[model samples]
Target: MEKLEERFERLERLAEYFIEEMADFKKWVVRFLSEYKREVDRQIREYKEETNKRIEEYRRENNKRWGELANKLGTIVEDIIYPAFRPVIRKYFGCEPEKTFMRLEYINREKGIYEEFDAVAVCQDKAFLLEAKSTPREKHIEEFKEKAKRFLQYFSEFGDKKLILIMASLSFKEDFVKQLSKTNIYAMAYREWEYMDILNFEEVKGA
Candidate 1:
């Protein structure tokens, strides 16, 4: 009986040892899993940040390429348009410009902003803000109107001069010309004869 009791006690101790080992194993697994989860989350966050940075870099590069291309194309158009524009204004308006300027860039030092006119022609009691475009769209018309409205703000001295917004283009959409006829703005085309043909000549004369 005594030997049997001793064997039972020994068995109990073995059982307790296994229970303690199982508890320790469970703790180790929990700790390892927690650390692994943390690592995975950290890696995911870093990967997202890197991906965002790369996307931003790609966007900036694309914008830069587009800007350079636009500048080059604009220069070519300006070369053809600037010289012919003044003559058109003279032929139709029946007067020569007192001052003709291209790309009239002005910076308001106080406002820290700048504005540019494609071409500005000032005749007596009249000023024409002419924008030469490879293709003229409706948005160009709206832009010219907005620019003309703000013209007085930039050049307060020209407040007395009538602002005539004109768009000189190589070609115009049919509907665009119709739309221009309805507005105060004028549209002109460079003809095959290399002379300016005012599309809204009659309408302007009537106005």
Candidate 2:
């Protein structure tokens, strides 16, 4: 009986030792998981910050490039296109402008709206409203058409005069020139050696 009692006591001590070891292992696992989770969260936060920084930098650079392009286009239109157009209009059309107006703004006080013209060259019997661009598109041509169609409504004083719509650009698409000619609008562009030349002059005369 004593021997049997001693065996039972040894078994109880072994059971207690196993339970303690299991509890220690559980604590170690919990600690390791907690540290791993914190490290992963830190890395994720850092990655997000870096990504945001790069995106902001990209946006700033893109805006800067667009601004520079706009400024360059404005310079070309003002310095080269406008100056060359005057001589070409005289040479090709044999019309000398009596008055050259720039940025003519008109407001309908009743409607509370306004329209603007880039330039207007007025002769004795004709007036040409000009739209100048670095790269002329169809939309620009359409806008000029709209303005010229409604010219008399705003400038009723010039009701007897023939209104001509003209566009000047550094370069033009052939398709755009064709479309402009179909509408009887004069499309002019810079040719080789950068002389201002009309693309649709014949069409304008024929129409």
Candidate 3:
């Protein structure tokens, strides 16, 4: 009976030791998980901050590029294409060639509206209502018609004794070109420079 009692005492001590060991292990696991969660949160915060910074930088750069491009386009319209059109204005309208006008506003059917146009070339007695299309399509007819009607309404104020609808399109459909021509509109496509008058060029260039 004494030997059996000693064995039971030994078994109880063993179970107590096992319980203490399990408690220590659970504490260690909890500590490790807390550290892991803290690290994950810190990393996520850093990544979001970095991503936002990059986005802001990209927006600034993109805005700058867009501004430069818009300025360049304005320069091309004012310095290059508008000047090249001087001859046509001089020949048809008998006006001095050194003229400049911007197509800023127009009236259609006597109704005023906010508008922007490609350009307006003017000499003393003639005005050219010019619109530039990167690649003109037949779909442009409605807009073109509106432009023409506007010119007809305001030609007298502009001293537009002669009216020319000058358009510069990168390209055009054959049917569109034919239809525009049939409408008695003087039109020129990219490949059709011969359609432009040389006498007008001579007068504009002082040749």
Candidate 4:
């Protein structure tokens, strides 16, 4: 009877030891799983950030390529400048265009004269002539003025309409805008690189 009791007590101690060992194993498993989950989440976050950055870079590169193609084809005027005409004319002149012409050309064999207009919008009693440049310069302003002087000669039908000249580009410098304000011509460009607008409307109109 004494031997049986001692064996029973030994079995209890062994059982207690096994229970404590199991608890420690469970805790280790939980800690390892938690660390593993955190590592996975961190990896996912880094992957997302890298993917977004690459997508943005690709978008900018694609836009630059398209812009270069447009410039090479001399379609920058049609692409960038033509769309701004109606809104600008209507807003500043308070009249919608009856007809709009793009890339208009005139050749007078008798006078040996040739002229090309980037855009033209004819309203009730007013006409807007637009000249666009990918890269604008001071010489371009003077050249446009000379072209404006001969506009009536080319299109005698528009002679009765009040002529309004406009010069357009992607953007303009402050000095360029100031110089344009001194002239009768209106300047149209991107405002804050967001949308196209007339830059010197009030100054030109008040002049």
The positional error of residue 143 in candidate 1, measured at the CA in angstroms, is: 1.8
Superposed on all Cα atoms, the candidates' RMSDs to the truth, in angstroms, are 9.2, 5.8, 8.2, 9.3
Candidate 1 lDDT at 28 equals: 100
TM-score, every prediction: 0.61, 0.66, 0.54, 0.65
Candidate 4, RMSD to the unseen true structure: 9.3
lDDT tens readout by residue for model 3, 1-207: 579989999999999999999999999999999999999999999999999999999999999998997777656546555655666556555777445676556546565454666677666556677776655677676678687676666555765446566665535666766656655454443445444442222223232
TM-score head-to-head 1 vs 4, winner: 4
Q: How accurate is candidate 3 locally (lDDT)?
A: 0.64
Error of 4 at 117 (Å): 0.6
Report the CA-based lDDT of candidate 2 relative to the real structure. 0.82
N/CA/C clash count, model 3:
0
lDDT of 3 at 166: 64
Best by lDDT: 4
lDDT string for model 2 (1-207, tens) is: 569989999999999999999999999999999999999999999999999999999999999999998898877756776777677779777999888777778898999969877778788898878888776766877777777766668888777888877888887888888898888888878776458888778877897
Distance from true location, Cα of 12 in model 2, Å: 46
Q: What is the lDDT of residue 3 in candidate 4?
A: 98
Please, what's the RMSD in Å of model 1? 9.2
Model 2 segments beyond 4 Å from truth?
1-62
Q: For candidate 3, what's the RMSD? A: 8.2
Candidate 1 TM-score, true structure as reference: 0.61
